[model samples]
Target: MKKYFTQLSYLLDSQAKKTIPLLILSFLFSSVLDVIGVGLIGVFLGLLTNPHFFLQKFPDLAFLLQGLSEKKIIGLFGVLIIVAFAVKAILTLLIQAKVIFFCQLLLVRLKNRMMIAYQYAPYTYHLQRNSSYLISRIQDNIGSFIGNVFLPLLNLISSGFIAISILSLLAILHPFITLFLVSMFFSVGLVFDLFVKQKLSSMGKIVSLSNGEMIKTIHHSLHGLTEIRVLGREDYFLQWLSKISHRYAHAAGILVALQQIPRYLIENMIAIFIIGLTLGGIAAGFSISGVVAMVGMFAAAGARLLPTVTQIMSAINQIRGYLYQTQLVYEELVELESITKGSKKIKSLYQKFDKLTFSTIFLSNVNYQYPHTDYSALKNVNITLHKGQSIGLVGPSGAGKSTLVNVILGFLEPESGQLLIDGKPIDNLREWLNNFAYIPQIIFLLDDTLRRNIALGIDDHEIDEDRITKVIQMAQLTEVVQQLPEGVDTLLGENGVRLSGGQRQRVALARAFYHERDVIIMDEATSSLDHETEQEVINTIKTLKGNKTLIVIAHRLSTVENCDILLRLEKGRITKVGSFADVVGISS
Candidate 1:
């Protein structure tokens, strides 16, 4: 129980100061209304026992009751009761509304922070986590925390105040009966709490894990649809989905049983206790009115305790589960480190190289290992490219080709070694990156107009229409655009699925070309294009020979045959470096 409250504290930390006041106000109002109602009941009973009870108690109070008969007195008491109820209702609504509103605000803030953290988190964080789990935490768990945990807590506090008022009234009327009822109530609550506390918590964990698994199964099935269809594994996927569904259903059943059975048992016990107490009170020579008031007090107290006890238990379970999920998201956000200002400012592969020289682009004893990998992807690799030089990087698969690109792009840091650009350490040349652009093998495009996708949200003033057109022509995409109904304005489907693979590659190339940076790094950019189209793009790149430095990665030997220099890498080390012809002869 202490642990549960500790966890609740952390969950409420975001809104604690703001919500506490409203909660307290609501509870106070509820207690006041309940006490006033009980006092009214006692007064009405006293008037029944003696018509002039109010008059005898205080003469001034009696004068205020002049011209009012018994019915009118009862009616007046009813009005007071209604007023008290109205005040309690209004206060309760206001506090609950504030709490729920503040909870929503806190949830939105937390989600936004998580999103921002995701952007800055290291690549390994993404690799280690599942998208479905993250999505479930945001979409489902936060809502559960507010509705199941916070709302129930609000209800529990309000009910507790009512219970205390009722118990106090009972004490004045019949102390022994009040004590007996209180003892019975607590005893039953304790037994129920002990019986289902662990079960509720365990059920909550099962439900949460099952929900994540169900989401994962659905996500995987949809994302791997093509693979599933191609392999004729629809039934297999369905079976897997069914297993998750079954687990969720089983856990839900247990949760419902745990929630309902204890409440039913406790309610039955309260009913029996009420019946026994009523008989005993009459036997003890209590007057008819006193007995009625006692029964009324018992019923009112039960009304408060039953719902409060049930809701509190369920809220505990819900809060525990939600806190775990929230902790996952919070931990993820807290762990992410923002990219340094220097990294973002480094030149892209397409930057200009007027003063860039061979010695300017040098990596000394570079070493890098991928996350969770035993061996280094790039080890002690060294190379240099001069300005205006066209260099081709050739290597087998997993030969550190992509890792090399990632390093230069500042997406990954080397375990050891220094990368330099323009005769300065790469970190110092943050602003120097404006002169380069990169075209990766797999291109991504928004589901928007071809022109907008290529321009990538650049303002019209910054857009170079002529340069864009030139690149389109060079990449052989002009014909494709012309063939479309909207030409350059035509919308590309999601991930550019509307375009052929080669066209997608060309669009990426066009974006790089439009940038017109001093250096262009093509990481297998032309692999998807036909031999002829690839040649045309290469020739177009050569046209800018004196203006830019070009570094190309190609699997096709013919593609790099005429390069100024070629570097062959193997096992994270550069093994051969020379002109294209010289390296090819040595490789052969």
Candidate 2:
């Protein structure tokens, strides 16, 4: 229980920390009300069975009943009982509604906070993690944390308070008998929990694991649909998902059954215990009225007490069954918080600067090694790039062309190097990166209007129409936009599935143009275009040669032959650097 509470603390933010204590205090008030309602019912039963007993027991109020007939007294007590019960019911409902609303609100806030952390986390953090796992952590795991762990924990606490309150009232009435009954109930409950605790915990872990696997399987199968269909292996992915689904269903079913099974057993035990109590009372030679009143009071207490005990046990079982999710989500929350701790300050610093103003960027003695690798991806690499120079990189596959680009883009940091802007070290990488527009080999598009995709992060009202039109023409996407039914308003489908390869490339180029950055980096951006289109785009790029700093990586010789400077890289080192003809060993 202590460990679970610790894990819960890790999941809560400052607001939740404050809200939880207030909620628990409310639970305490609710439990007091439960005791009051039950105590009133006991007094009501005592009067119904033996009016003289109440007159003798609560003698201070005996004068009020002197003029009243028995029926009138019973009728008045009945009204009091109804009112007590009604108040308890109303308060319970209000408390429950508050609990549900708090859990839901916390769920939303936690999910949003986690997403923001992921967005601001270092690029290396994303490279090491799987997208499917991260997605499930956000969508599925946090929900399980709330429903299975936090809600059940709250129920356990609330039920526990009510059970103790009811038990205390019963003890005040019949001390020895209540003590024996509580001992018996607690002994039975303890034995049952010991029997099922390990099994329930194991099943919970299995459920968490299976949920993540199922999500990963589905993510992979959907993302690789074309490959699966081409390979004629639909059953392969289906079988994988089927196996995980079966495991998840089986574990989840067991947890549900185990949590509820205790209620039935505990209910029967309470019934048997009450019967024995009545038999024992009769054996003590009490008069009929006395025994009836005693039994009535005990029965009323039992009625309220039994359900609370059962609820407490059920809540314990649920917490045990979902313990793994609690721990998993706790760890995730802690890790995300630590990773994004400095992100806010960094983001603020990034916002302090506008467009970067620099004539040169120099990589001084840069060195980078990939995680868990013996070899450096960029070893003693040095390069200088001037603004308004069209530079090209030509390299073979796996020759570190992309790594160098990533380093230059500030996605990867060198072990020992300084990225200098205008001959001074750049202290703020985020601001520096914001001044560049990057186009990668692969394009990712949102399922939104083409216009929104082009101006991806801009608000609708803030988008400049004239600038959009100009970029559309510059990227050679004017014809494509006109061909669409709604022009730029047409939906692009998921990841631009509706567009052809060249058209997608054109859209990417259009997006870059819309950003209007001082530096444009294209990593094989025109590889998807046909010969004529590629040449036309290259010519468009040539037009920006003297205006914007352009860095282009291409395998095709003709692609960079007209550049102001060309570089050839091999095995993480720059092998050649000159104008195209000088580097290629051919006269211009």
Top TM-score prediction, candidate number: 2
Q: Quote model 1's TM-score.
A: 0.82
Candidate 2 lDDT score relative to the true structure: 0.82
lDDT of each residue in 1-588, candidate 1, tens digit only = 676565456555555667677667867776777677666656665666667766775678777888988878877877876787687678767766776777678667656655655655555566778989877776666666666666666666666676677678778767987798778767866787777777766777777777888888888888788999999988987998898788878877877766676567668877898888788789989877767766765676666667665565555545543455545544444455234222343223223344233335777788998788899999998877787888788887778877887777556778999777755665423344555677766677989889877887688688778877887886678789889999988999888979876678678767766765667887874345477656754674566566667787877767777678888988888988997767788543
Cα displacement (angstroms), candidate 1, residue 13, comes to: 7.1
Regions more than 4 Å wrong, model 1: 1-27, 34-63, 147-176, 337-359, 386-390, 422-438, 448-452, 455-476, 487-489, 510-520, 525-540, 543-550, 586-588
Per-model TM-score, in order, reads: 0.82, 0.95
After best superposition, candidate 1 residue 81: deviation in angstroms? 1.9
- Choose the strongest candidate by lDDT: 2
Clashing pairs in 2: none
RMSD (CA, Å), each prediction: 5.0, 2.1
